[model samples]
Target: MMKRARQDAMVENAAPQTSQENKKQKTCFYGSAFSESDPHGSIDWGSLPHHVILRIFQCLPLVDRARASSVCRRWNEVFHIPDLWRRFEFELNQPATSYLKSTHPDLIQQIIKRHADHLQYVSFKVDSSTESAEAACNILSQLVNCSIKTLGLISTAKPSFMNVSKAHFASALTVVFVNSKSLSSIKIDDTPVDDPSLKVLVANNSDTLKLLKMSSCPHVSPAGVLCVADQCHGLKELALNYYILSDELLLALSSEKHVDLEHLRIDVVSENPGQVEFHTIKKQSWDAFVKHSPKVNIVMYFFLYEDEFDAFFREETPVTHLYFGRAVSKAMLGRIGLNCPRLIELVVCANGLQPLDDELIQIAQRCKNLTAMGLGECEVTCRGFIEFVKVCGGRLTQLSIMEEVLIPDNDYSLDRLHLEVSKHLGRMWFPDMMPTWMQFDAKVTKTLQVKCGIYT
Candidate 1:
């Protein structure tokens, strides 16, 4: 009798509870006339602030941001801002043509038309194949009609691999030579153009050309570069790799009135007459460089091998940046200390490095103004880094140590040698493979801010 009474009460409690739950579910799903149901996971574009949305778009890479604008009507209206697309043409690794093809081709063409008068940076990759080359030339032709201040064309194919006519590319490039009054910088690599075409390009548009680079171009000879130097008086920065830039060209640049030669990088792979190898900077060449202009502040040394660097580093000339691929011996460092007082940055990346504790200490003492340094793939242990820090404790600002150099050890128990570097927290960057240090965020934030010129 007691069991039956309990069952009746339990049934009564369960019946009201189930009915109340159903009422709540109905209210949530079908909403009452007084209140609306929340649409979870749905995006409310009208509610989001304009500036916040634009900021989010700006955070994306140039290529991504371009695509994001095409997603909807609201995005299309926001992307028309001028400041957002000023340097949009020169985004690193940005293939504008492919993105245009993926989306509405006519839409991209319209954007280009609207900004042609203000476009400044144009970067594109071209192929040696006829069809792709034609497409590239067409895109370039559109940019040529604009005020493209900087143009970089990276062709991946070997020069010998393609024997196409200069007329194929030059016919389209002629528009740039004639109309691009604001074209200041040009970088062409892995493809060599004919000398006559190069001559015509420079002859027609040399006044506005400030920087020119041609790397891995076997056909563009020393005579072609001489023509460039003779014509382009406003040339400030020039980069050439494995091409002959003759002494006559240098002399012409030196003698030119109102010449603005600031940065010159000559990477010679072949022994071309009239063009001096970086390793063989003679007294006359050094004299000519100094006499030419006081504006040339940055010079780079890119030797083909360690033997080349060994032959080159004996120069007493001053340079702001030095890049070599080997361990710098104490004696060589001593020579650099004596000669390059204004050295601001150094990069060492090679297999042959036997870093001495004393040599690094000496560098810290000598190079007071050295702000940036890159030690790429050196076989440095934690103990070696400790020694490195002991010498460059207060002054070291930027340092890159690959993960392979870290000593294998357990946590909590610091090795005697590693302790020295591990304790002093300046700005430290670690490879992703390594274990995260305790002070990772603080160090990265501090370092990135300083590197980005935002000191606080």
Candidate 2:
């Protein structure tokens, strides 16, 4: 007892270390001139501040953090810090019932028990197996005290192999929605996110929701989506299927109470090819949308059958970005000029034999805002191409014209066209080209670069 009292008295009487004393101590210990022993070997890691060590551990992944915590008792304490588990994603790869690529079940339970409340931005990216989905669902069901802000359930497996049906997924998600009332972004594509789960989400997170991207969810209907659009006035970005997009939907999004919408992406998917009995939005609705929110970008991606396109672009469409992955007809290309005045970027993956001469010219003349263009298996004559470029001028920044796309004749040559277009671009440019198989040696080429040496 007397010895313990003597040690306590010495500690109490010890002088507080000043900056100069600390610097001197560091120099004496670490910067001693020409030390024979290894300085790194004698370094005291325990002397480091808790915050500094925590920062170092914060930069590492969860697996690395766990491994590093085994080094000592101090680091183990730092590893268990609540701040370290605020944002996390479970990488679940299920090949069999016992297989696991991410965290083990025991580790996940520990995380839930200790740090579930700290989790703010969390996601579960799982493989296509039913086991993977079940694992993800199990983890989700355990998040009782979680206050997750952004949640994304991404299926790494193909949709065909996805056996974990919608009812189970939706049931699990309902728990997360009920808990995380401050959710701002959600991306649960191909999941069974039905109307009831959506209603629960809206009830909990309508005021805070900003972006929602659920493309190819078969269970969600137009009424369910309309409910979201009407309730979530703060929604700025949305990506959904074509069936949900309507006049009422667009007008609802353009409400005076909401801020100007930023991005509206539509996935025009086809369950059965050549299905023609599909709905299309009217032109009046688009006009009203444009008048209300002129800065909004409406990006559309088409994965439709050739016959299914007739239902789309029938009126003055407000699509700013358009991609035609299928073989588009000359009539459809022409309709793009008449209907899609707000079109800025156009990419045609494949088109029919009919030359888009007038249609190209009409697009360049009418759609003055057009900036980028890509034609893969489409034909446009040299004169028509030049006229299009002349109208677009420097604005056609991303022009990818394949060699086959330019059908040359006697009047407009590739060589002169390159020169004229280069003058407008203010820099040398080359069209993305393919080798001509038809009489390759006979094809004329364009050269934009000329070398002039000072010695010469």
- The lDDT of each candidate is 0.58, 0.78
Error of 2 at 12 (Å): 45
Give me the displacement of residue 112 in model 2, in angstroms.
1.5
Q: How many residue pairs clash in each candidate?
A: 1, 0
Using all chains and alpha carbons, the TM-scores for the candidates as numbered come to 0.60, 0.82
Query: Model 2, 384: alpha-carbon shift in Å?
Result: 2.7
* lDDT tens readout by residue for model 2, 93-192: 8556335576677779888898999999898877767777788888898888989989988777665214676777777898899998899999887877
RMSD of each: 10.5, 11.4
Q: In model 1, what is the error at residue 407, expressed in angstroms?
A: 8.5
Tens digits of lDDT, candidate 1, 245-265: 555666777774748588777
